[model samples]
Target: MQNIWSIFKRELRAYFDSPIAYVVITVFLLFTGWYFTTYFFLAGQADLRVILGIIPFAFLIITPAITMRLISEERKTGTMELLVTMPIHDSSIIVGKYLAAVALLIAMILPTLVYGITVAFLGDMDYGPAIGGYLGFLFIGAAYLAIGTLGSSLTENQVVAFIISLLIMAAFYLMDKILIFIPNSMVSIVEYLAIVYHFQNISRGVIDTRDLVYYLTLISLALFLATRAMAARRKR
Candidate 1:
């Protein structure tokens, strides 16, 4: 636990030490603010449905940027050897790095609170759906970050990592739309596998156990894959 915390601090500090965190956060806020403001003025609604609709696309770009250099840069600079030599499990290292990414995401999400607060003041707002939307974003973001971490683990080049992660995430994000080409029998299977379907379900304010399980399973699987990738590197 201590080792994980230390690694978390180190990785989190690394994000701030460079321009990566600032650039990602700034871009995220700018885009989200634009989308939210545009919808807020046009719709005159207090709901966050517009903003929620933008999140998947925002994450598709932002998450890859956040996780591009996580492990890839370590290996590129030859620090991965030193990291693996530490007296700790690879899972610890993966989780520590993954958590740092998640923390950065949380920071990005925090500033968006102003949007919700503004809506509350402008009109009658139902906090239930808003809260549920935030929860959905957090869970989905964690899964995406885990996937990005796995992508980073697969290569030592940051550009490759970013591209790999972006492709994977884009596929998942577009799963629902792509499922239209499949037969009816396969629609249910693909729908169940699509993250956006579950995200929408939870965003509607009804939290189903199946949706929770889907996200947790995806997150665990991605993180497990990342840990295994690191372990394989250690063995070689």
Candidate 2:
């Protein structure tokens, strides 16, 4: 546990030392802020419907972009050897890296608060939905980051990692949309596996245990796959 915490702190600090993290966060916040102002204030009578909804869509790219190099960069520069040589467990490294990526995602998300503040200032606002919406967004981001981490572990090339993770995320992100076109017989099964189906329920400010479980299960599955991939690579 101590070793995991040590690695976690190190990984978190490493993010601040890199320009990519800053650039990604800045760009994400900038574009999202523009959309928020445009959709909610400039057009939609102070309703945050579009802005709240677009948060997770934005994460489909940013999460993978942040984690595309977590393991690939380590392998490219030979840092994986040093990391493996340390006393930490493989799970520790995976958790630390995954947590760091999620933290950066949270930071990128923090600036979106300005949009909420702006809406509140403009009119009467119930902040509960806004708060829950952001919570749901964070959990969704964590799950995506975990998937990105697993994708990174599976390949040593950053571009491949990004593409793999983006595909995985896209499948999950669009699962509900795709379900609409499928036959009625398969709708139940498809909804069972749909990420956005569950995400939408949460976005409406009700934190269902089933939805929370879905994200938790996805994160656990990704971590398990990442651990297996690292173990297999170590045997070579």
Candidate 3:
């Protein structure tokens, strides 16, 4: 427990120690802010549905950028060996790093709350969907971050990591569209496996257990794969 916390603190600090954190956060917030303002004015409604809808697409890019260096940089610079030699489980290290990524993501998300507040004051805003949207974003981001972590584990070069993560994310993002070519029987199965399907389900203010289960399962599987990759490094 303490080991994990120590790793978490180190990972979090590493983020701020570099300019990447600042750049990513600034770009994300600025882009989202601009889009939110545009959509708000165009719709002339207190509803944040448009803004919330676009957040996932923003994350499709932002998440890979944020997570690309999580483990890849360590491996590239030979620090991974030092970290692995420490008296901690590989799971702890991975979880700690994952937590740090989530923390950064939360920071990226926190500023958006002002949108909700502003909408509430301006007109009749349904807070329920807004809350659901935030939750859905977190879940989807978690799944995506886990995939990014896997990509980071697979390569030492950060650019390669970013590309791998981005490609995988893009595939998942377009999973529904690709389902059209599948057999009728398999279409339902493919749709069920698609991240966007479950994401949309939760975004509609419906807290369905199946949707939560889908994300949790993906998060677990991705983290497990990352941990396995880390463990494999010890053997080599």
lDDT of 1 by residue, 1-236 (tens): 99899999999999999999999999999999998988788766666778889987799999999999999999899998898888988999999999999999999999999999998898776788888899999988988999999999999989999999999988888888889798999999899999899999988889999999999999899989999987787677
Query: What value does the lDDT take at residue 230 in candidate 1?
Result: 74
TM-score winner, 1 or 3: 1
- Top candidate when judged by TM-score against the true structure: 1
Candidate 3 per-residue lDDT, tens place, 135-221, comes to 998999999999999889888889999999999888888888788799999998888888888888888889999999999999899
Off-target runs (Cα >4 Å) in candidate 3 are none
TM-score of each: 0.97, 0.95, 0.96
Clashing pairs in 1: none
Q: Distance from true position, residue 212, model 3, in Å?
A: 0.9
> lDDT of each model, Cα atoms only?
0.91, 0.84, 0.88
Question: What are the per-model numbers of colliding residue pairs?
Answer: 0, 0, 0
Residue 11, candidate 1: C-alpha displacement in angstroms: 0.8
What TM-score does candidate 3 get on C-alpha atoms? Answer: 0.96
The TM-score of candidate 2 is 0.95
lDDT score for candidate 1 against the true structure: 0.91
Ranking by lDDT: 1, 3, 2
